[model samples]
Target: MPKNKYSLIRYRVINRCLRERRYVTLQELREACEKALDISPLSDRTIEGDISAMRHDSGLGYFAPIKRDRINRVYYYEDPDYSIDTIPLNQDEIESLVFAAKLLEQFKEIEIFKTFTDSVQKLVDVLNIYRISGMDTVRNFIEFETVESNKGTERLPELINALKSRTVLKLRYKSFTSKKISSHIIHPYHLKEYRNRWFLIGYNEEFKAIRTYGLERIISIDTEESKKFIDIGFDTKKYYENVIGISVIDEEPQNIQIAFSEMQAQYVISQPLHHSQKRLNNIKDKIVFEYFLIPNYEFYAQVLSWGAEVEVLSPKSMRDSIKQYFDSILFKYNH
Candidate 1:
């Protein structure tokens, strides 16, 4: 006859009953399963199969050491605390587990995953003790991009902790354009990743405005436990909706139209510059793209990167800006 459909569950139920009580008769075990585990009453043959399977089955391999009373026909574990949950794995199974642990360890460098470092290290220690075969070769087979830690990356742990605790932070910062250091107390809202760098979005207490500070510019950060956290209810999506990269300009979003030469248009079509990009009517040798966004520093830089292949078609102010930028660049090269 086939084993019970829920053979594993029956094993666990039988294991518990044998462990808890000094001795339990077959009928008593069935009653406990029905009441405590919400399981259907099992037959004598099914319970007997479960006990046999738990002892020898490679998947479980539980050394239950069950003893039976000859006079009363009751069963119990010789070692009361013994359970299938603590079963030891074979060498092959241990190596397989070690491989899985190594995979998780690879991602520990990422800022968001910093909290799991201790747990991941514990797992790695087990792997080292076992000295799993081909463990050294595992790192070589798979390669992960290791980004160098920038200036402010060392402060990630403290910043993340402050954000989690909802504490206000005091940051000593120095911008690239400025030599002097400035201090501001900010309520951190979000951590944004862009172009291989990290930025913190927060409510600046001194300026009374929402601002983004690049992690590279931060000189030092300390949390203020005494200050009550102030949440201005900033809408992240709407705030950055029309802006590109990390910059948020004060101007209203406008329709931005640009014409790209036919040669360069294909690349733009494949990978759109902005999420709000829409293709417009193409001229004889140029493909036009219309984007709805606020003109920010990053957006301006992106337009400049394309150089002569692209031209601003609408928004005269932006067109003038781009023209003047090119004129200056040309004058510098000529000199």
Candidate 2:
């Protein structure tokens, strides 16, 4: 372990002793930390320094009220009830926690999360307690974009189980463009979410290739008990590393350059489109940005969402594709 980890362990040990034991001697604290970590005897000087740091280190945020009895040479907390475990949270932190609790409440009815139901309830109870105790300043300051009629979230438990047990799945799916439903035998690899939609990414047995299926389009899902589960050893991170959203193509990543209007540039700078995005240069009134990514349907749609405020500078193929799309739109309007 690192030196900081050891120090943290020592601090926890000291805190436990101060909270539980009375008239704890400096020697006793050292012995306790050494025994807990199963290490060599810690010196008295080291123990004293630990106590000093715990009491005065503002970075630690644990300005423990520690005092010593001169007569008995014993140390203890001035407030018996004081413990690091019950550290006070600031108003902003409390509000953020309350908001998170609200989000977690949405998943309470899901079967897989039944174990966490009690934990989530406990958090709500704590928040309520805080509210009754005069910290009732928590408000609905943040709102999340939610899909009211989102489908397939109920399949999360079964999908998660199949992923864990390496179970093959039989999925009946219908695409947005298709009227007929198709059945597929898939080796479940991963479940992904993008823009309030869930998708199943897996190895399609019939297609003999990896494919993505939107959960909203799924009609039914069942276990393929007869088929043996084939694991492709999918590295989720590496697979989606270069792509924006959930569409992962087989092509190599392109050096994508885009120029954004000044207004849109501010938003891009604040919340970057991709991890690989970097500011290239300023041209006229536009801010040029660079991204190393595999162009996909989602990438095109994202660029299109900004409309005229953003322009794809290079990879002529991508630029032409966007131009063709605009031309088609113009042709439709003109016709």
Candidate 3:
């Protein structure tokens, strides 16, 4: 027999023997392989070469515990302590793990959710130690619902790619109310999703100002000669600090506050308008939930959603706008 083939035969024998036996005295390995695998194994030199090959090969080197034990002159597995066995995982548990991995990916965008995701991982691993997910649960599983449709299908993939590449995009956009098409040269800095709609924040080259554009309203996106956006950085938290809506704070700002009736307080508390929201004492007739913010179209839109349920308590500009909006909305239905 060829020397190489004889050494290959010796390699497989010692590999398995080492995991259980701790050490093989060259002769013992060849004898054991002959007994267990029913192969006419080779002599001592061949077994020695096999052990050397096992230590070197990346995959098979997992059996190096034998050499380490031999260095300390120790050999024993039969205080009956153990043996190497396949980790038992049925199909359902595998699927549950894949589901968990997908869930972690879903929350990858939200910076505030880091600690919560980490805690859930630790809790799941601990549960897995004792109870198998496939065997026990009867597959009473959680599923995330998709949006009705990909209204922004093509733009969605492009937006993600641009964010990854940090490239600039020229967008053909139409406003929700006004379908007039216009072009915007934007360097997309961040993507924000709120209430199932996607928003892009970027520095608009044409306007020479930072702007927020909705992905759904974007008619088309063209990759321009890519230029890096270095000067302008979007701090999502700071951007939303003083505003309840999508509109950025204007140069001249006011402390805009709103008061809600008892019926509306439940809804206001349920969805906080801003991070800086503070609750003041409730008036006899109304619940005053105070937020000092810039009054923008986005803010006005939110206020209008309340209809007669809320009242603007401060900043006369906001109050007047609310009155005008109410008049406009009422005219549509009342007239």
For each candidate, C-alpha RMSD in Å?
Answer: 9.2, 6.0, 16.0
Look at candidate 1 and tell me the lDDT of residue 226: 88
Candidate 3 segments whose C-alpha is farther than 4 A from its true place: 1-146, 177-179, 226-230, 249-253, 331-334
**lDDT (10s digit) by residue, model 1, range 1-335:** 33455676677788887777769998887776666557676577767767777766666667578777879899888787787767766666666676676676665676666688788778767656666565563434665555555666656677788879888999999988888999999999888878768899999988889989999899888878889999999888988888889989678999999999998899989998889999998888999999999999999998999988999998999999998998998999999
Predicted candidate 3 versus true structure: per-residue lDDT over 152-269, tens digit per residue: 5446667888878888888999988785899988888888776667788888888787898887788888888646654476677887777755668565556667788888887778
lDDT against the true structure, per candidate, is 0.81, 0.86, 0.66
- Using lDDT as the yardstick, the better of models 1 and 2 is 2
TM agreement with the true structure for every prediction: 0.62, 0.73, 0.56
Query: What is model 2's C-alpha RMSD?
Result: 6.0
Ranking by lDDT: 2, 1, 3
Give the 10-residue window scoring lowest on summed lDDT in candidate 3: 78-87
Per-residue error (Å), model 2, residue 98: 1.8
